[model samples]
Target: MTTTVLQNIRPWGAESVDLSIEDGLVTGLAPHRPGSAVPGGTEVLDGGGLLALPGLINSHAHVDKSWWGKPWVSYGGEATTQGRIAHERTERSALGIPSTDSTELVMKEFLRHGTTATRTHVDVDLGVGLDGIASVRAAAERLGGALEVEIVAFPQDGVMRRPGVLELLDRAAQEGATSIGGLDPAGIDRDPVAQLDGLVQIAVDRGVELDIHLHDGNDLGIFQIELLIERTVQAELQGRVNVSHGFALGDVQGARQEELVAALGEAGISWTSVAPPGRGRLPWASMREHGVRLGLGTDGIRDLWSPYGDGDMLRIALGFARVHGLRHDAELAAAVQLTTTDSAPFVHRDQHELAPGSRADVVLLEAENVQDALLRTPRRELVLAGGRVVVEGGELTL
Candidate 1:
């Protein structure tokens, strides 16, 4: 067993400690000792008293379609979702959207920002079929396990509007996608019941998780959310269903909002948000009070749809904090947690932290505490993904 000891690092800004790793999992942690001796053949790295955080988790990403590492493509898509969808379909093929090289570049950007794991949505439509998924898998393999990516077979285009998409999603599930994704049932498909029912049936049949993107706002969006809650309970998919960008939750007010939040908790449905500015702030306090899980993400950085984001989860967390008006230290720290330990379930990890028995996915930064790190977004000094040094001194070593 190859062993590595990271000496003199502060986990979550706590006292300095030496963290030991063996075969990619944290084996032990001891109080930092300057001259501690190790067995022969053990690799040692000095941490320089940097604040250590568990590698950031990107709960929602579109890794397959990012335009990173390519020449700057001017954004020409309409601001609407459907417009963006059409624009991408019209232009993606010429740009090679799902090639392994481009996907690898996106993964490298994530690693450089200390993101060791992600639950990325790969477009699974008629145009690309399963090629996007294959490309993402190949990219991850090329990285040699430096990043853990859970796949979601996403119907980026409307599912019901286009035939064969349901079958594609089904095939993706059978071929080892951890989850199948859906788009706005009412807005995009115009058949909320049929769309939700179809996706839910696939989830029940394939035994895979379901993650639906809901961008429709107001009553239409709320109506579909209710349908999802009903079906999730009926299908016994509690804890296996997620709503990405369910903006309706933020558009409602008063008792109706309270009821929906409560129902979501009881049904075990979680939510993931990119925290886009100018949108309503999520009722995070109520969501927390009712046991609802929330995960943060950097959605589609430098994609054709929008020219924003750099795949940095810290900046995303800071945006979330600023959008939610978080002022207290604990609140800011919790925001940081949204991108790290609290996001483990988003990527299907039972535990993701700097403690023993967790994967040795650690990020060391020059910050005094978690809040400071979130606010300032410092460059990572060292990043160890699965016990392998992938980044050092703010640069990718892999």
Candidate 2:
């Protein structure tokens, strides 16, 4: 068995600790000892007094359509959501963006920035077929030990409106998709019941999970969420479901928001936020209090939706905290948790704890403490997964 020691590190930026890893799991964690003796055949990763934190997990992202490391493309389509999708499809097709190359670029970028795992939503339609799924899978296989990627067979266009998309989604699931994805039901499908029914059926049949995109605002969005809650309860898919971008939560009043938060928690449905400004703000604090599974993500990276997103969860989490006015140390620390501890389980059901006997998937930041890590957004000096170093000196080794 291989053994490694992460010496002179501060976990969550508090108290200097030394972590001993054996067989990819943390075997011991205690206060650092000065001039500790080096055991033979054991590797030592000098933390240099850096802060250690669990690797970030981006719970919702689109890796197949990122334009990162590519030329700029301005959005010239109508401002509507469907219009943007049409334009993006056209542009991606015109560019003939190969999945093997683009997906690798994006995933590698994610790895370089301390993300050890991610749940990427790949488009599945008659037009795209399973190209996105295949590409993401290939990328994951190539980097076998570096990072974990969960592909959600997503129907970007309405599942019902697309005619035969549900069948396509099922095929994608059979082809190794870990989750089933749904688009706006009331906003795009125009039928919440049918869409939710189709999605839940696929999930239950294939033993997969559900991640739906809900962009409808106010009553319509709330209606769709209620439908999801009803179906989730009926199907008994509480812990296996998630609603992405439930913007309606931002428009509701205090009591109504509390009601929705409580319902979501009781149902065990998770929520993923890209932390968009204005109408995209969610009751994250209340949801956390209610025991809701909340995770942060970078929705789309320079895609047709907007020219933002760089696959940087730390930057996104920082902005998420600032947008919510999280100025206190503990509050800021919680923001950091959104990308790490709070989001890891949502991305991969297997718990990734920064404790003894837990997988050593961690990032050593060049900072004084946890708050300093977030405030300064320090560069990662080292990143490890399962006792193996995937990144060293802020560069990818695998």
Candidate 3:
């Protein structure tokens, strides 16, 4: 086995430590013992003071609806004709119905930006069942270990507002969908709690995860979230439930928001992305201050929903950096946990880390210190999964 040694690596502590890779995993630590020998087929790699955090997890993505270097529509103004366009795009991608030449380009861009794992929601409303689901599935499969994807059967139109939304979601799950999706419970005048419960049941019955998109920014939204927490706790579905785009939480001020975080923490259910930066306001700080188990996600690749995302985990982490005034070292730590273990619960994986006997999913970055690594987009010199080098700088070898 050619042991690859990342001469110096920065870990969570914001300190530089030398690490060695054997069979695609950390084998020896220079910090543990200085001047460790090359295990076998060893190639020396210099940290160059870049941060080597864990790969990033795109908590939210619509891979079937790839950017493909296309122009994305702007914010809320998208619910109309643009949504229809996006919906159709999903159907074409899922059926493998010969997308524009740009489709392949989309997936390539995703990898270039360092998003190793992405959970994408596919539209499957009405006659279009699991629209774009197959496209993302195929693409994710092709990427194999380089990039892993989790698909959710999302009813882009509405649950109650659309026909067979629940049944279609169920079908998508049965047809290899990794999880199910939910939209604004109150947005469409549906019983927010009922919709939540129904979706939760579908996830439970299907033995899958639930990734919901929340749009209620008022008491209605908070009520729905509270009900979700209540149901998750009752079902003991810890780490298996998540609410994406709960920007409404940011709008709700005072004790209620504090209560929401507390309840969510106890239930082990988390919300993604406080709110887009400079969009009037955000609740990320308060949510963190309240000790909520929050993680960052690029809610959408390019839609009326969100127009800015390159699937870069570093960028997402950096977004948190600028919006919340996070220091560099802290950003490094955020990137580490955000991708690897912190998201294990939502993704249904066992704990992972550099510690003994973890799954050996490690990334080697070139940075002298943790702060430098995060402050700068350190090169992912090596990305190893299951003790095999999957990606290294310019070379990608699965």
The candidate that wins on TM-score is 1
Clashes of 3: 6
Better of 1 and 2 by lDDT: 1
Runs of candidate 1 exceeding 4 Å displacement: none
C-alpha TM-score for every candidate: 0.99, 0.96, 0.80
Q: lDDT tens digits, residues 1-398, model 1?
A: 98999999999999999999999999999999889798889999999999999999999999988888899999997889999999999999889888899999999999999999999999999989999999999999999989999999999998999999999999999999999999999999999999989999999999999999999999999999999999999999999999999999999999999999999999999999999997748999999999899999888978878889898999999999999999999999999999999999999889999988899999999999998898899999999999999999999999
Mind sharing the TM-score for model 1? Answer: 0.99
Q: What's model 3's lDDT at 33? A: 33
lDDT, candidate 3, 123-237, per-residue tens:
7777556646766666666665566677778876768766578998988888888888888777763777668878888888888878778766677777788888888888778
Candidate 1 lDDT score relative to the true structure? 0.94
In candidate 1, position 362 carries an lDDT of: 97
Worst 10 residues of 2 by lDDT: 93-102
Worst 10 residues of 3 by lDDT: 95-104
